[model samples]
Each structure stands twice: as structure tokens, then as C-alpha cells.
Target: MADVVLQTINLTKEFTKRKGLSSPRHFFDKVTFTAVRDVDLTVERGEIFGLLGPNGAGKTTLTKMLCTLMLPSGGSATINGYDIVRQQNQVKRSIALISSEERSFYWRLTGRENLKFFAALYGLSGRAARSRIDEVLELIGMAAAADRRFQEYSTGMKQRMALARGLLADPEIFFMDEPTKGLDPVATRQLHDFIRDELVRQGKTVVLATHHLAEAEQVCDRIGIMSNGEMKACGCVSDLVGEASLIEYFHLLIEESRLEQ
Candidate 1:
């Protein structure tokens, strides 16, 4: 009975190696790699939740499942209390998905052109979509470069543009994975400001997945650390950190995970 925007119940995903030269043809090797397993995560309404972990800790996989990019092998999840497996369409509409340097959008198109296309897809057309695009551009300080080709845009600009696409739908939930991955300190600060200020001010729920424990500690009201497809702990920064400084706390958190079998 939690006022949660996102929740997962024993969620799991498993992949099998298809070894071509194995004994069996189309070898379905008994080897099972669990990318994510038995994870129980909850994001409260109007809070920025952090999914903290190192690379290959399955943060991206978890984000993808939440955003409906992939199906989990077991358990159930809900977005806005709409079952992800059942009411997927509704879930998709309410969720904004962003990732770092993976699948994105038209590099050939101008920044404005790109936003226009997504706005149309989200059913915002003509004046309404234009208005929204302008709003986000101004919010992200990309108004001046709105007409520039995405290929010519800086890394930070591209990140902001990807974020704008997510906002075009006016979604209530945002799933961002390593959003500030390749940016410099200044750009990272700017992106952090948007997530911490703009998103929170609007009462949006965010689930941020990143390796930067320092930033996560600063922004997340609560954090969950994962390793080898399982979550180690989940709680507020002060709750987990206790006497240690934020930097000291992150090392302790990581060390705790590494100690687990």
C-alpha cells in the first residue's frame, strides 16, 4: 500500500548462450546468465530514485524492462499502477525513456526537426507541439541551437535533445540510464540541475541509473545498489551513509556489494 509510481515484484531476466560450435546444433547451452534477478524495487511518487551500480551491474537492463523495451523472464512490474505486462500501452505512454549513446534519433535532422517528429508521434501537433518544443528548448538552454543539425551538436546538446524527446510526451515517469555519461563537469552540472530542479518542481517521478555514485548521492532521495543481477540494499542517503561523508559512503556501499557472494 505504498504511494508508488514504479514497483517491481521479484522481477528477473535470463539469457542463454547460443554457442554455434557446441555439441548440439543451435546449442541451447544449459549455461544461464541472469542479467537481472529477483529484484524488488519501488519508486515513490514525486521522488528522484537512484539505481546505483557499476558497469554490468544490470542497471540498464532494469531500466529497459521498466520502460517496456524488453520483457522480463519472470515476476511482474507496474508503471503508475498499470501492469507493465498487461497494460503496456498505457505504461509506454506515461513513461519517458532515455539512455546514453545507445539507440537515439536522427543525426541528420535539426534539433527542432527532431523534436517536431516526436511531438507528432506523441499526438501533439502544430501549435501545441511547437509551443512545448520551445518550452523545453528554453528550459534546457538549447533555444539558440534549435535549428542546428544533431550531428553538429555537442555531446551535452545531444543529451539535452534526447531528454527533450522524452519530455515531448509530457510523461509522468522518466527512466534515464547514464544520462551524464560523457559530458564534462559543467555540462554534467547543467544536466543534473534539470533533473533535480525542473523535474522535481513539476512533481515528476524519476528513476536514474548511473555509475556516478557521487552525483547519485547528491540527487537521489533514496538509492538502491545492485551487483551481479541482484540488489544489495535500498534506503535513503542518510540511512545508508550514517556517519560517513557521501564519498566515504559510496565506497562503503560498493565494498558491501563486492563482499557478497
Candidate 2:
């Protein structure tokens, strides 16, 4: 049997939006927005599972819930056999999150310095931290440039540094949200190759939340198509698209979701 590293059952998230703070009646009245609804999925160890969706489609929301960054309003999930809610710390220890936000790092710090700081947060210090930081820097092909300030690096280099930081924990699973968001074509392809050739080779499962259809088809072993905060379809690219192009099928799924709503 395949080792299921991550699983979710009816996992959902809802946010309450208040109409107006000025009015007493409006204060009591709230509109609920379901960011993710009844999302059921499974990701096996060492396989790339893509959450393919456009912005506001709840891919990031779901990823956040799984990473234990945000609490789920309903349902449940597990990471590496630990419940995400009850065993939050264990779940966090087993997973690393890499987001597209470039501002999360200290701009004044050099790449190696940034990694060293984060490594301390993960409880690594002294020679161990240095050795691990060196390993990940080399793994991300940032060894030579590790001493450069983060603000001076190119967009692609910044993203690679983010990847390096994620690897510091040496977690079993990685949650990457729009990792290739601002990259040009060449950079995006290079990142994709690094994900497939390097990360997977290290026996890590990746939960990639991305809007890029081509990226999903190329990097994912299996995909879950999410629209309007729900999973519309899931399977291998060949199975999900069949005779139709992935773009065509994606549009079809979105339209069908709209009609259902």
C-alpha cells in the first residue's frame, strides 16, 4: 500500500464578515464566506500533489489549514499520522511551508544569515545548524551566493532561498503556495526541475497550491482541481483531462461549478 503522508476529511474553513461597525444592527449581522468546503484529499509520501485553482479558489486557504497556520472551522486532517488540530506542534514539525511572499525574510540579512536564524527556531544550533544550512544551500544551488544580502538577490534567487529555508526543518512534507508566482518562464522551469529532480529525490511529499495549469500538469503526479472553494475533480492529468486539453477541461470544471452554484 502507498504510504499516505497527508489526508483530509471534509476539511473546511469559513470566515465571518461584518457589514458595518457604525451600526448596531450591522454589527450583529454577519456574512459567512466559505474559503474551503468539504475538501477531501490524500497525498502519498514522496509524490507531488497539486491543488490546482485560481486565486480565491481556496487553494491557499486549504494549504494554510493543513500547515496549521490557520485553524479549520470544521472537519479534520492529519499529517504524517498526526492530527493537525490536536497535534499542531507535531504536524508543524513534519511539514514546512514556502510561500510566494518575498517580504517575509529580513532584507538586510544575507542568505546564510537568514537560514541560520530560522535554523535556530527549529532548535538547531552550532555545528549542526551550520552543516544543515550548508547542505540546503547547496541543495538549492545557492551555496556560492549564500553570503549575499537577500534584497540584492534576483526574484528567482529569493524563491530559492525560501526553498532552502523550508528544507532546514527536513520535514516529510512541504506546503508551497504559489511558489512560482513572480518568476519568468526560464526561472519557473528551473524551479520546477528543482522540485521534481531534487526534492522528490530526497523522499519528500509536496503539496503545491498553484494557479498555473501548465505547472500542475508538468510537476504533479496527481491533481485536485478546486473552484469556488471546492474540489471539482481529482486524478492524474491523463485521467482528468482525457481527450480534452487540460485548459479546456479546467474551463469546463469551472463552468460546471458555476452552474451547480
Candidate 3:
């Protein structure tokens, strides 16, 4: 059997609804939304696994639950054999989340300063933090602009900084949500190359959540297609594609999901 680095067994998340603050029964109101339901998935060590879904497909919510950033309503997960709920700290230490959102960083801080600050949060300090920060800057090809303020950097550079922050802890698994969102084709290709050539080569297991079928096909070893809070299909890229193109296969699965619902 492959070395499974991440596994979720029927993991589920539901949010209870509340009425307006003026209503007396608002506190008692209990409508609910199931964002993720019975999601059973496995990611092998040192492979890029893609979770492909449209917007609001519960990809982010599932990621948050696995990362221990959000609590699951049912089921459980393990990261490198550590239970996510019972061993939250161990799970957190073993993974990193790279989101496309640039607002997560302090706009006033320089690229290096932002990285240094985040590195400090991960417990590295002084010379050690500086060394790691420098190494990451070089890794992302941002050494030349390390001193530039974050707001001054273009969208591509900001994305690189986000990647740097995620790499500061040197986690074993990386969870990336739409890493190339809103990027020009050139920038997107650059990020894709970095991910495959550098990160994968360095032996990190990556779990990528993206809506771009072609990009996922290019980078993922295996992919799970999610729709409306459920996984419709999962397999190696070739298996998933077969005679159909990835986009065609994706649309077929999505249509099937709609009919099932």
C-alpha cells in the first residue's frame, strides 16, 4: 500500500443558522447547512493530489477542517498518523495552507519583513529566521525584490510571498487553494513550474484545491472531483480523462451530480 500522508474518514461539516438579532427566538433558531458531507479521501506521501471543484463546492471548508482551522461536525482525519482532533498540534505542525488571498499579509510590511514575522510565529527566530527567510526568497526567485513593501509588489509577487509564508514551517504536506487564481497565463505558468519542479522535487506531499481542470491535469498525480459538497469521482489523471478531455470529463461528472441531487 502507498504511504498515506493524509486521510479523512467520512469527514463532515455543518453550520447552524441563526435568525435576526432582534428576534427573541433567534438564539433558538437551528437551521443548518451542510458544507461538506461524508468526504472520504486519501492522499499519498510525496504526491500532488488535486481536489477539483467549482466555487462553493466545500473545498475550502474541507481544507479548514483537515488543517484544524475549523471543526468538523462528524467523522475524523489523520495527518501522517496523527489524529487531527485529538492531536491538533501535531497535525498543524505537519501541514501548511497556501491561499491565493493576498490580504492575509500586512500591507505595510516588506516582503522579507512579512516572511520574518510569520517565521517568528512558527517559532524560528533571530539568525535562524533570517536564514530561512533568505532561503525562501531565493527559492521563489524573489531575492532581488525582498526589500519591497508587500503592497508595492504585483499580484504574482504577492502570491509568491504567500507561498513563502506557507513554506516557513517546512511542513510535510501543503494545502494550496487556487494558487494561480487571477494570474496572467505567464505568471500562472511560473507558479506551476515552481510547484512541480521545486516543491514536489523537495518531497512535499501537496493537496491542491482548484477549479482549473487543465491546470489540475497538468500537475496532479490523482484528482478528486467535488460538486455540491460531494465527491463525484476520483482517480489518476489518465483514468479520470480516459477518452474524454479533462474539461469534458469534469462537466459530465458535474452534470451527473446535478441529476443525482
- Top lDDT hit: 2
Query: What would the per-residue lDDT of candidate 1 be over residues 1-261, giving only the tens digit for each residue?
Result: 668889899999988766657756656656778999999988888899999887778899998888888999998999998988889899999999877772487889899999999899888998999999999998888999999988998888899899988888889999989898889999889888888999999999999998888888888899988877888778898787874465664576567657753
- Backbone atom clashes (below 3 Å) for every candidate: 0, 0, 0
Candidate 2: tens digits of C-alpha lDDT, residues 62-162: 99899888999999999999999999999989999999999989999999999999999998999999999999998889999999999999999999999
> Which prediction has the highest TM-score against the true structure?
2
Q: Per-residue CA lDDT of candidate 3, range 1-261, in tens?
A: 889999999999999877557467666676788889999999999999999987778889998888999989998899999998899999988999998998999999899989988898898999999999999899898999999899999999999998988899999999998989988999999988988998889999999999888899999999998887888788899887885577876787667656755
Clashing pairs in 3: none
Ordered list by TM-score, greatest first: 2, 3, 1
Error of 3 at 198 (Å): 0.7
TM-scores of the models, in the order given? 0.91, 0.94, 0.92
RMSD of 1: 2.6
Please, what's the RMSD in Å of model 2?
A: 2.1
Cα-based lDDT at residue 115, candidate 3: 91
Please say which candidate is ahead in lDDT: 2 or 3. 2
TM-score, cand. 3 vs. native:
0.92
Clashing pairs in 2: none
Error of 2 at 191 (Å): 0.8
